[model samples]
Target: MQFMKFRKIFSVALAGALLLTSTSLFGEGNVADAAVISSIPNTTRTLKSYDNSFLSVTGYASLSGGVKDRSSYVGTSYYRTVKTSREFLQALLDAKSGSVKVIEIAANLNLGWKELNLSSTEIQKYNFVAKYEDPTNGYTNPTLQANGVSKINVSDTNGLTIFSTSGSTIKHAELKLQSSANDIVIRNLNFDEMWQWDDVGNHKEVGWTFIKVNGANNVWIDHCKFAIGADGMVDIENGSSGLTFSWCKFGLEANTNPASDSAIYKSITYMEQKYTSNQLASTSLYYKMRKAGATPNQIMAYSAYHSKCHLVGSGDKDYVNYVDSNGKDYKDGNQRLRITLAYNQYSNVGQRVPMIRQGVGHMINCYIDDTTHMNLENSVSSFKANSTSLARGMNARNGASIAADTCVYNGVTEPIVGTELQGQDTSNMDPQWANLFKNAYNRNLIVNSQVTNANGTYTGSSWDNNGVNLFTKGFVWYNKSTLNKWAWSSSIVGAANMSKTKPPTTPFTFQYNYTEKLPYSYNAVPLNDVVQTVKQYSGASKVTLSAKDWLKTVYSTSSTPTTGSSVNVGSYYRIKNVNSGKYLSAPTDASGTKLVQTADKTQATSLWRIVAGDTGYVNLVAQVGSASKVIDIPGASTDNGVQLQIWGGTAGADWQQFKLKDNGDGTFGILTMISGGTQGLDVNAKSTAEGASVIQYNYAASANQKWVFEFVK
Candidate 1:
């Protein structure tokens, strides 16, 4: 009996819940526990439920405000009221409003401004100081006497500031909040329309951030649609504690005026300028964008106050950066320059914006999908991380240090888990933009979820690419086998030695593909049919066998064997010494059956010849388990009548070879030895019914010989 070699990587899922001993370094204090609130009316009214869940501000019911009574109180629970953005702003600034019991913001909060004017050019034209009717009001109105606009401040006097602070537009909203000392909960409200452009075909430049919570603890933004907007659909402020944005849709709007040209150029310039000023703390911000609307363009800016501004970019070319020499080097004015912008796109064309900046950015267990053109910057320009940075997207850009412009794209691919850059679409083009801004932001997940491609090729890089373009992680999928590079983590080797062109063996998260254990099984065939069948479906063609030896040619790494072959453990072999009429032997089975004895030899003349026949009978009756690759001949075999032959000749000519050696004990050992060994299978007897005469023949050259042993006592 001869043994064939087989190799198997440890399955990640097979490893049961790994007990990660709680450590001070990787503590669980940061892990938030969330309570899903229902969409029904007023479920989050009680302050107790909001306690410890972060700060939740719900505005589901109508809020009544009388002229004399400057305070706006939440109306009855049953009343489904519409709260416009103006009203929300009023309520937030209402003097009589007590300590916010979690910014309980809710629906119908519209932003209705028709031809409004302003005085302050610095803040925004629509900037109006909320003044309490009474002199003792807690909030004080900012001075509005810019030039000659002293009396032109009230809504009636100025008609209302419809479009104020430029850059991104925000409109239409609702919210329900429950708050406690350390947490907040916001449920069942829409964050729709950032800026309402005039034309139906234009894309808006404004981005609306529903709730900008600053200096809070344990925040969760989930099940929300941040659809259609020019600016960030949702922006979490700096110094916020434990925030999560999950199950949300973020994309561009099909119908809206393109974002103002000046605003975009200025935003980028502003970010670069700010970085130039702060060399110690600020780094480049990564902005990722997907192609959408008539023109797929994106813009981003990194804030100045916050530190750790390490930036990178993601998404398509449309979402990347455009370095221009327009605005004054205000950032570098009279100061030594410290930073630069090393920006790049996936394909050299496309627009990208910094939807997310780094303030405490973290995307854990979150998904980024279906973005035609995206710019994923690594700096803290737009999207900030409040928790973990485990995201999914088309690509991503990362930087090394502050003032660093060196950014690279973390293109989304498969089996090679990336640094969260991923997509759900396999098509070459971007997914269609939606009528609403929120839908566009979330289009990726929706499109990816609809991908039923049998091959699981549901991403842009998956098609028209080979293994080099496709990346496969043992567990976490990110690398593109086509590029043959690992964009994020180092492959097995630490990040320092990680290959920019190879997939990492280590996973980015616990849920990587390696977490699952695969069950082993084989295709059954008669002893007379083993050899022929294996020939048809074995080795590099149908097995994980190294094609280098089988094909007798030097092939690319991709052409090498993978884990797509089946196992055939029952194939048997008959080993006989050429000069000495003996066979290999080991401990006998319960039935006292063993290989014919053979004296070890040291020359090629002592070769063995083999023939195909049914050996299952010998295996069953003899009590010797019908295992694969368990024998070793004293000498090698020659094309001639090699006397010493341990052949597993099945139906066809000689094929299977027993290379895998069995453990001295009864158990079969691992085949496919990495160091040095042949990968193939040996034949087996049909059963005692066949008088142990059924033995097959073959060479060791396929995954079929790699048998997954299941010991039966």
Candidate 2:
């Protein structure tokens, strides 16, 4: 049967990987690798490098003071003289004139931007980085003006750290604009020693912090880690789009080693003394230097902003569950850690929380566990709390208008107009926050146990609970959106606590088909490699028997009834072969063989029959040349209500016809219409009954038109 249009797009990225281990998963593959790019008539040049290059990375190719007219060439590091940041800027200006394509720098390098003429005014979009031989003590520049530089990829051996020499915090990066459309990629690095403490006079303050791109689009910080003692992690704001922080480790504390105590302590004291002389507060120094020796100060901790950085892969939980200074847990709320509200287009995600006020601040798929403070203002957003065992606080009383909030415990307090709140069921399951207020807890905890809280009482059980029972109590859950973003185990196998007898024994298989009971003689099979066989008989043959088919022999019959009494019923058996006099010659035509009901039986039961008859001569006929053939077969005299139809019927076939088939309760109508054809019957309209005809008729509905298709094994 054809399914609805709501079917999902099959994932293909990791299909081959997932298929190696299991059979129930599909993933989307990489689209770029398979992309085909045609020809472009442009001169292409390759690059190679040697020792030190005193040459500037700006537009033109220059060696010392002389300008070369050559297009491209592999050169050494000593091509130009070592100079100040001003020379670098001048070099860049000249390079753009020649339309230089690519620049490669190899080995021991030091880029001095101290004299660089970058302003705090213009937006610069330059993609450039220097590779350092020693991962440590590399690229001292982290402060760049916010140009429209879209992409930045930084790689160092030790870690990638950026600190400011100026008194102000490193708010944004300063790069020149080469292209407005740029994608940033920073990998194989860590932000180490990128923070500094200030302890000048009496006023104490946190050291110099780096506030990364306030509003840059498509920032990806992958395969990188952060060492302790940075005032701020990468501050991604100002409507950064497609922000994916994958496989990057943040909130990592520095390791304490006695061997490095002297070096570490000297640097710490120097910073303290220098900042103190600079008029920094003493209290800040005391708190920062509380731990003596090699232990780094508590720079990064779980805070409203610090704890909610965008994370992917293994670092997902680190941002939320990190221990605070007071050992109390804290998490970001609506505004503190917000995903830009997502619009129909994927790019709208960044627009949700655009840096500018009165701008779009739409955040989505965010977990506001415990310490999250919701303060949505002019703009509305969508927040999804997927914490199964976590009671996320949605203190929306701060006057933030939320369009949609899923699984959050606290919000506007009372339900708002045009707002939907699911998960308040007080049925078989208990929906409580305490059981769901822990890490790595199952969502089933809320559904299995009852919790009598001050707010109200919630009752329900399992994911199947829906309707008002789920809507009024708490949060609506297990939605399609959550499933699409998160990964679920395909081999998840566990037992339910309901009852052994009620749910059947273990070793249950997974079946992709609909959940229902199988027809008689067929047992439910799991989606495993096991298979069983049974004999299947044809139900449309002329030599058919009534419902009184007795068991030839019971496999293991007991005389004593367990709780019910048994009564024997009259039965019949099929002959090894049909005798010409006993059965009619089955015709190859659409009607098959028509038999008449005995006159003694009621009209309902004896309406038709298929007994011995000559070819082309039916014993009893009703629908002539119409599909859905109906025959009145006689049961017992009082049991004359049985009316069966032939399965092999097309449109306009007489023997395959029925009318006004009532399902006893009179709730549905199975109308079968014979489209301009004479083969299989066409169901014009049907609200119930699988594969049954739902046809439209020109006249009144009759018994000769509606017949249920029942397969008897």
Candidate 3:
């Protein structure tokens, strides 16, 4: 019904798949299709079977990641693996309308670094703006003023999908999607460290959010583990449309590792170097350390880090941007601010379980549990400072349409902000927010009854904030309710010109909805099963997958490499680079001998024997002067041009071991798992001349990285 107002942005506003025609979202199952096939032994949550139906995202964000959801080969034009923060940001920069990419995060990349190290060529070639937050300005030198925003600007594109492996986290940063970002999917990652040293800790002036989707469309965020951020978890503003959040855990734990080398502690140290003394003393850190008597290392360990979960629209008329079939674009209600929340867990959070100002929202089987804290939050900066009130829930104003079906709440004060803000100038009881409570059902309103009971009745007295007022009293939870009445109705406050802060030149009434068919169809798991399902399969590592295995699912092929792709154990061979047509050779089978690409394959130094090594990998032993030494990435350096050498190794360490990845053709790309991502062997500069050097580089599937194995055991 939400999409009925739309004039079809692309096609006929697909009912089956949101924006694309695909298989059903849930695939008619109760359990999740979340398992991945894994062979690495003794892994946690080791998966044995995988259809991955749950991978099909439902609701407004179904169009994200284009038509496909699985990761592809690194050699493909659209797929890459990133480890560092710069690489992660560069992956976003390299994508746009014509260029689409899928980025797989391989490590916990910290974005709080004060500067980006730009090479000399980029320094001399361009006149760059010094704002480090925005890397589009060439060389970025981060200043504290710019909000340190590294954007995933997928402009005018069908989509860009960013996901992560089991061990990766996008820490100490904020991900903002703005300016015509379209059809994006962010999945299977951990996020944290937006929490900084707020001056007063009122959280009014600190403007750091975990993920801000501004004017972006068809975005789906799935299976992400969001930690305690500085401000809100997600703020979808300025008319972003068709957003979905599925199986995400917001605020599981605070980043409390306060060791000197910890990310949060390092950020604190970095902030100390840039600010004034008074500014430093006014920090939330100072409040915790000086006032609450906490050490620098132990101060953050007491943070219950989440507050202000989601804010759908910044203002009433920050309308969505939409496109018609004839290519006409409209920035209005018909195409803006529609969101879906399915199977999300909000733990130890404060409020705004999505306070939508306008547009439509559908919440199915969501879990908003705020009963406990993840850390030992002090009274000075606890999310609930008053110690008398409970956390507020969903609120809607400005005639927006919202409905919560089969949702659950734990220790939530107001299921829909009715009792919490009754006397608090809610625009004539905020009649528009009535359904947010009535439709969702305030289980807390029932006396001595379970919130999970479908047939529960509410005869209990309404909630009041004990004695603590909105202006403090250091509000804390675990207080007795003070107020005795409940109020909510269709007090839909509407204005001819809905804009509150910024008014349009010509005033127009905002299109408000009481109910709107969802833009897509989905089968949500029953309300009772939500807790179990989410607990079993939400956030990173729960849906265990490696980039390699996900690619196998996409290609639908065997796990093994192709013909002659295997470097047989105890067998000798002369390996030749495809691009250079040169043999992999060294002068002597001794330590420190650099491997070279020689033209003559018949030379004795060119011969290599394969020894058993790590699983799915082999140690290439060079045979020369009646001695054997294993091929090694010297010092296991991950630099781009690190030369390979033959060294002695009783066991092939990850550095000494090389794995063969089949290119499907007769050739294979030799890679190492130790370096992370696709670090592979390559011939320098594609040189065909004899004695050309061989080095390790990021795998781009270039001819230099592909090798042909000529067996001669």
Top candidate when judged by TM-score against the true structure:
3
Give the Cα-based TM-score of candidate 2 against the true structure: 0.25
lDDT per residue, candidate 2, 540-603, as tens digits? Answer: 1111111111100011123322111111111011110011111111122243242321212212
> Backbone collision count in every prediction?
230, 111, 18
Better of 1 and 2 by lDDT: 1
How far off is residue 78 in model 2, in Å? 20
Model 3, residue 95: distance off in Å is: 1.6
Model 3 regions lying over 4 Å from their true place: 1-52, 63-75, 119-152, 254-301, 317-335, 374-390, 418-516, 526-528, 546-713
| Model 1 agreement with the true structure over 187-228: per-residue lDDT tens digits | 223444332211111122222234443323344333333443
Ranking of models by lDDT: 3, 1, 2
**Per-residue error at 533 for model 1, in Å?**
43
List where candidate 2 sits over 4 angstroms from the true fold.
Answer: 1-181, 198-211, 258-267, 271-713
For candidate 1, the TM-score is 0.26
Model 3 C-alpha lDDT per residue in residues 149-194, reported as the tens digit of each score? 3333345555577876443676545667775677677777777656
* Candidate 1 root-mean-square deviation in Å: 30.1
